[model samples]
Target: MSTRPHLLYLAWGFPPAAKSCVYRKLATANSFARAGWDVTVVTLTEDAWIREQGVDRSLLALVDPRIRVVRLPLSREDIETDIRRFSEDRALRPRTWLKRHYQQNVSHFPEATFGGWRDELVASVRRVYDERPADLLLTSGVPYTFFAPALDLFERNGLPYVLDYRDAWAIDILRDRPAFRPDSPAGLYEARLISHATEAWFVNGAIRDAYADIYPDRAQDFHVVRNGSDVAIGTDKIPMRQPGPDEPLTFGYLGTVSFSAGLTRAVCEGWRIAREANDVLRRSRLEFRGHMGVGANRGASAQAVAIAEYAKHGVSYGGPVAKADTAAVYEAWDALLLILPGGRYVTSGKVYDYVSTGLPIMSVHEWDHAAAEILSDYPLWVRNDGVEAEDVAEAFLQATKVVQGATVEDRLTARRHAEQYERYAQLRPAVERLTTRFAPGLDHVEPVGDRAPKTGEDVHRETSVPGPHAKGERVVLALTSPPSEAVRRSVALLRESGAHVELIGPDSVLEELRGLADEVITLQRATAPVKVSPSTSVTRFTPRWASVVARNLGRRHIIGPYVRVVGRSAGWWLSARRSPPAMQALKDATVLASLDDSATYLIWNASRLNTRAPARAGIGATLEELGLTRI
Candidate 1:
C-alpha cells in the first residue's frame, strides 16, 4: 500500500450543483490533493443536482483531475418542480405527501429533507474507508446529516474528522435568530457532532463567534476558513477600462439573482433614480449575469420578470455565465454591483471575486453585511447606508463617478488589496496547519507541481478599451389597494423626486390619489376567494393522537395519514404563493414600498418565495430584517 495519507471529503453540494457552496468544496478537495494526501470527494450525482438546482458542466472543469470524486445517487425531493415525476398519491395531495416524506426522513436523521440519505452516506464512507483507511474525514454541511456518517466512521474505526460549516445549522442567517432551541433534536445532534470533531471550520468570524458562544468549551477548536477567490480559475490578470465622458459605463452584477424582491426593487429603483439625477448614470447599463432562480422557476422567476420590465431602463439579464468565462465577464463591466441580503451572517462567495476584479464596486446591501468588512479597505468601493431607493440612487451616482475617474494606479491598488484573499493563499495555510497538527508525516509534502500564478501577477495579460455610456430615467409602477396615508405619502415623495409614477388599485382609490401619482390603473376586486391547488389547510390535534396510536398498534396506514396531515400544516404555514396581480406589481415596480400590513405581507411573500425558510412579517419588521430603517 502507498504510504500517502488518505482524506475522505464529504460535500453534498460539490461540483455540478451550481450552488453557492461549490467553490469552497472545490477548493477544499484540490487543496487536500495538492498537499500530497490521497483525496476522495463524495458528492451527489449531476442528475440529482439537475432535478434540484440544475447542473453547471463548466464547474466540472475547475475540479483537479488528480482528486477522485464519487457521485452518490442522492437528490432532494422538496425542490422537485416537475409535476410529471410525482406519484399518484403525491399528485393527489402534494403538500401532504411531502410533509410525510420529510417526517419519515427526520425520524431517521436530524436533517429534514436530507435525513433519508443517512444510510447511503454512511455506506459510501464505510466503503471508501475499507478500500484504503482514511487518515482524516472532512464533512461540509448545509444538510448537517453528513455528521451522522462522519460520527459513524469515528466510532467504528477511531477516524478523526473535521466539521466544515459553510452556513450554521443552529442559527438562522436571515433573521439572526437561533434556528433551533438548545433542547431540540438538531441542537442535540450538533452538540454531539462537535464534541468529537477535531476542528470546526466556519466561513467568517461572526459565524465562528456564534458557534463559540453556544459551545464555550469547544471555542478554541473553531477556525475561520473564509471563502477566497480562485485566481487560477479567474482573477489572474487584471483588466482596467476607463469610460470616456460620452461613453456609457457598464455596471455588472455577477452571481445568482436570489436576493429578496424588495432588495432587487431597491437596486433597480436606485439605478432609475440615479439615471434621472445624473447624466452619467442615465447613460449607464446594469447587467446581471447568473442563474436567476432555483428548480423549475430558474430564469423565469419574479426577479427575471422585473429585469425584463426594466429593460428600457438599462437593466438586462444575460443569463448564467460560465465559470471559465468569469474573467471575460468582469472585463466587460466598468463597475460591479454587489447586491446581497442578510446581516452579519451572510458573507457572499462573490465578494472575493468582485474584489479580485480590481473594478469599482457599488454595494447594494445593508451596511452591517460582512462583505462591508472585507471591502472596507478596497480602493473603489461605493457603499450604501441602507436599502432605500434614494440611498441606493446616491450610491449608483458615486459608483458612476468613481468608474469615470478610475486610473491604472487605482486599479492596481484594488488588485493588491485582494491579494491576501486568493483561494490558494487561504487554503494552503489551512491545509498545512491541518496536516502538521493531525497527520504530521504529511507536513513535509510539497504541492504536486507548481500551481497556477496568483492574481496581480504578470500572466495572460489583456487590454481593455473604454466603452460609451447610455442615458435615460426609468419608469416606476406603484400598486395600492385603498390608498392609505402611508401610500399617499410614499407616492407624493416619488412624484416629488421626478419619478414617472403609475398607480394601480381600485378606481375610487386611484381617483382619490390621482394628483399624487403620474398615471392611474383601476383594478376590479374579486368577489370570491382565489382557489389555488395545494390549498393551505390547518392540521388538527387528532393527527398527533392518531400518530401515537398508530405507532403503538404498528398500523402504517394510520401513520401515512398522520404524516401527511403534518406536512399539509407545514406547507400552509411556510407557503408564500401570491395572486397574479400582486406578482405583476412585483415584476413591474421600479421600487416597492408598502404602507399597510397586507401590501407589506404581499411584497414580503413575493421576495421570499424561493427562499428555503421563508418567514412572514409586516413591512416594518421586514425592512428592519433587511437592515433598512425605511424605504
Candidate 2:
C-alpha cells in the first residue's frame, strides 16, 4: 500500500466537463496533489457532461497527471437526447416520469437528481479507502449527494472530510435565502453533513457568512476559498492590439450566455442607444462567445434570439470558446463586457480571468454583486448602476472613454491588481490550514465523529442558541417581481423564524413557493392584449399603412418615444391594481415587505391606503424591523 497521506476528492463536475466550476475543481485537486497528498478524484464520466453541457478537450490538458481520476458510470438521465434510450414510461409520460424520478432519488437521499447515486458513490469511496486508506475526504457539491458518501465514510470508518460548496446548498444562492426550511429533509441533511465535516468551504464570503449564521457554533470551520484565475492558462499569448483612432473597437463578452432574456434585450438596446449617440460606437463590434444553451435549446435560447435580433447593429453571438483559445479571444477585444446574473452571493469564476486580461472591463450586472466586490479595486472597470438599458448605455460610453485613454501603465496596474486573486494565491492559505491541522502521522488529531453530530433541532433546543423567528407574526411578502436571490433569502429566514408568510407573486412561481409559504396568492398575467404595430411591418410594406405612415411619420416619431414611456409606467400600475389578496394581506400584516422595485409602488400605495402595518422595501429592512438577525 502507498505510504503517502491519501485524499479522496468527490467532485461531480471535474474537468474535461467544461462547466464553470471546473476551474476551481482543477485548481483544488492540483493544490492537494502538489501539497504531497495522494489525490484520487471521483467524478461522473465525461460522456455524462458531453450529453448535457458539452465538454472542452483543452481543459483535460490542464489536469495534474499525478492525480488519479476515477470516472463514475452515472449520467443525468434528464438531459439524454437519444430517443432510442427512452423507456416506455419516460416516453409516454415524460413530466410524470421526471417528477417520479426526482421523488425516488430524493427518497434515497435528500438531493433530488443525484440522490439515487448515493449507494454507488459510497461503494466507490469504500473501494478507494480499502485500497489506499484515505486519510482525508474532500467533496465538492451539486450532486450534493456526494455528501452522503462523505457522511457514510465518516460514520463508518472515522474519516475526516471537507465540504467544498462551490455553490451553497441549504442557502439558495439564486434566491438569496434558505433553500428549504431548516427542519425540512434537505436542510436536515445539510445540517447533518456540516456537523460531521472537518471544514466547510464556500466560493465567496457572503455565502460563507450566511451558512455561519445558520450554524453559529460551526462558524469557525467555515472558510472562503474564492475561485481565482489560473493566470497562466489564458495569458500565454496576451497579444495586445492597438487599433488606430479611425478603427472600430471590438467589445467582447465571453462566458456561458445563461442570463435572462430581459437582460440580453437590455444589452442589445443599450448597444443600439450607444451607437446612435457615439460615432465610434456606431461602427464598433460586440462579440459574445460562449455556450448559449445546452441540449435541444443550443443556439435557440431566448437570449440567443435576442442577440440575433441585434445582428444588424454589430452584436454577434459566437459559439463556445475553447479553454486554450481564451487568450486569443481576449486578444481581439479592446474591452470586455462582464455580464453575470445573481447578486452578492455569486462571484463568477470568469471575473478573475476578465480582470487578469488587463483590458477595459465593463460591468453588466448589479452594483452590489459579488463580482463587483472583487473588481472594486480594478482601475479599468466601468460600473453599471442597474440592469436598465439607459444604465448599460451609460456604462458603454464610460468604457469607450476608458479604452480610449488607456495606456501600457494603466494596463500593467490593472493586471497587478489581479495578482492577489491568482488561483494558487487564493487557494494556498486554505490548503496550508488543512495541511497543518491534518498533518500526516499526527495521531493526536481528532476524528470528526469524536465530536457529536449537532443537528438543527439540537441547536434550536440549546438556550444559548437564539431562535430564528418570533411567534404569532404574519409577514406579507410582495415579491410581485420575479423572485431574486436577495428576496428568496429573506423568505427562507421568515419561514424558518416560524412566521406565517403570505406570498404574492406572478403565477409562474407558485410551484417554486408551494411548500414554503402559508398562503400563496398568485397574480396571473392579464389576459387582455394591447394592439400594437407589428415589428415585421418595417419589412413588409402595406399600401394603406404606407400612406398613413408617410402622412404622420414626423409626428409619430416625435410622440412615439413619449407614448412608450407612459405605457411602461401604466403597465406597472395595471398589474398592481389586480391583486386584492395582496392589499388585504398588507393591511393585516405585522410587517409588509416588497422584495424588488417592481412591487415598491404597490407597497407605497398600500401604505397610504392602509397604514396599519410597518412597510419595508427589502428583506434586510424587514429582518431589522422584526429584530431578527441570522443566528
Candidate 3:
C-alpha cells in the first residue's frame, strides 16, 4: 500500500494553464497535499497549454513540491497555434469542418472540443491507477469535459469520485434554470456522472442547491466548498495608509477580465454612478487586472468590450495583476469594486480576496449572490441591488462615504470577517473529510463541509425537470439548445400548441427557457456542427438564394440536410493563393449573409459579418416558393 492515501486530482486548467480556474486547482491540490494526502494531478501537457492560455508557472509558487502533476500529451486542436499544420480539407469548410469534427469528438465521449482527448485522459488515469491504487479521485470541471476520464475510471475500478463543479454543469445561475434538458444526451451524461460521485463540490450554496435539485437521489454527496480567500495574505503589520491630499482615490479590481452581462453592467453602471455623484470619485481611477477570457478570446473578449466602453469613466485596464503583487495592489487601492454575475448562488473566488482587503467594497451584482452573503456583515459594502445606472451610481456614492468615514476598527472588522474564508481555512474541514473518507474508518475522520449533503442530486433532478414535450407535428423547428429567452420567445407560442420545437444549445447556457422546447441538445454549442458526408445531402437550389446558395450549397453527411455551411469571415479576404485552403474555401462558400458578419468569420474576413444567418432562413422560405425544399 502507498505510504499515504493517494488522491487523484483531475483538473485540466492546472497551474501554468493561465486560466482563471488555475488558482482554484492549485489551491485545492496544495490543500490536499497539506492535509497529508499524496496528490497526483492529471492535466494536459506543457506544450498543449502553450497553444491555449500559454504557460505561467508563477501560479505554482504556492504549490506543494510533493504533489505530482501528470501532463498528458494533449492539445486542443481547435486552438492550435500552428497555422502551418492546416490541411486542405480543414481549410475549405473551416466552419462546417470544425462543427462536424467537434460533434464526432463529443460522440466519442460527452464533451465537444475536448472530447477528443477522452481516450488519452482515460488512458492516463488508468495507467496511474494501475501503478498505485487511488483512494479518491477529485475532478474539477469548467471544461466540464474533464469528467469523462474520471467516469470511465469509475466504470472499471469503482473508485469513489468527486465532482468539483466551480460553476455548475446544470442551471444557468444568471438566468437560473436547468442548464440542460433532463433527457438530452448531455443531461443524461450529467445525471449518471454526478450520481455515482462520492462527493459533488460547488463554489457556493446556490450551486449546491442547484445540484441537489437536479440529483436528489445522490444528495448525500453534495458539498459547498466555497472559493476561499487565500491564507497567505499580505503580512505587513503596518496599517493601510490614508489617501494623500494630492492623490486620487484609486479603485481597483483584480483577477480575471470579464464582461459577463452581470459583471459588465453592474461595474459600468456603478462607475457612471460614482463618477457623476461624488466630485471626488469623478477624479478617481479604476484599474482592472487579469485576463479577460481564456483560449482564443484572450484580450479581445466581451470583458475587453466592457473595459473599452468604460474607458471614458477614468477606468483603464493596465492588464492582469501578477500573483506576487496581489497584496500590494489591494493596499494601493482606496476602495474595491466587487462586480459579479449570478444571483444568490454566485459568489466568485474574488469575493474572499476582496473581503480580505481593508478597502471599502461596492457590490454591483445581485442582492442574492453568494458574494453578497460573504459581505453581509462587512461594514464597507454598498450593495447595488439593481444594475441600472441610477441605482449603481448611488451605490458608488455610498461606497465613497464608507471609504472616507472608514475607521481602523472597520478595516479590522472586515479582515476578521474574512479570516474563516482563508483558502486553507475554508478548505480545512472539507480536506479533512475527504481524507477521512479516502482513509475510511480513521479516528481522524471528521464530519466537515457544514452544508447538508442530504439534499442530493436525484431529488434536484426530478423536481427541476421541465414537463415532457407536447406531441410533435412534422415541419416544426428543430432545436437542441439549452434554454434561453432568444430561443424561448422564438418558439413559445408554437411550443404551446404542441409543435415539436427542439432546442439545441449548450449546458453552459442558461436554462430558464426549458419549457420552450420539445427536446433539447442541451450540452452543445449551437455553432458547433455535426459531421455529415458530402454525398448525403443534395445541392439542388432555386429562388433568391439560387445565385449565392447554388454556387456554394453542398449536402452535409453527418449533421443532416438542414445544416449548411456559411463562411467564417475572419479577416478581409486574403489573396486566395496566399490564404490557407480553409480560408480559400471560405472565399468560395455561400455562407448565409448574416453569419458572414460574426466574430468566427475572422478567419475568412474579420471585417465583415458571415451574413448567412438571416440568409439561411431566407433561403428556406425561397425554396418553398419554388416548391423544392429538398433535392
lDDT for model 3, please: 0.61
* Tens digit per residue, CA lDDT, model 1, 474-558: 2223233464443344345445545555554546556777777666655433222233246545245677555545444542354
Cα lDDT tens digits for candidate 2, 477-550 = 76645664434555666778778988876777666877778898876433322223775444337776566565
Per residue, candidate 3 scores C-alpha lDDT tens digits across 53-86 of 4556656676778888888887877754222243
Best by TM-score: 1
Error (Å) of candidate 3 at residue 554 is: 22
- Screening candidate 1 with a backbone cut-off below 3 angstroms (N, C-alpha, C), the clashing residue pairs are 99-567, 247-468, 247-469, 248-468, 248-469, 282-471, 282-472, 283-470, 283-471
After superposition, the stretches of candidate 3 with alpha carbons farther than 4 Å from their true spots are 233-239, 244-247, 261-266, 269-273, 309-312, 440-631
Count of backbone clashes, every candidate in sequence: 9, 5, 73
Q: How do these models rank on lDDT, best leading? A: 2, 1, 3
- Per-candidate local distance difference test: 0.70, 0.75, 0.61
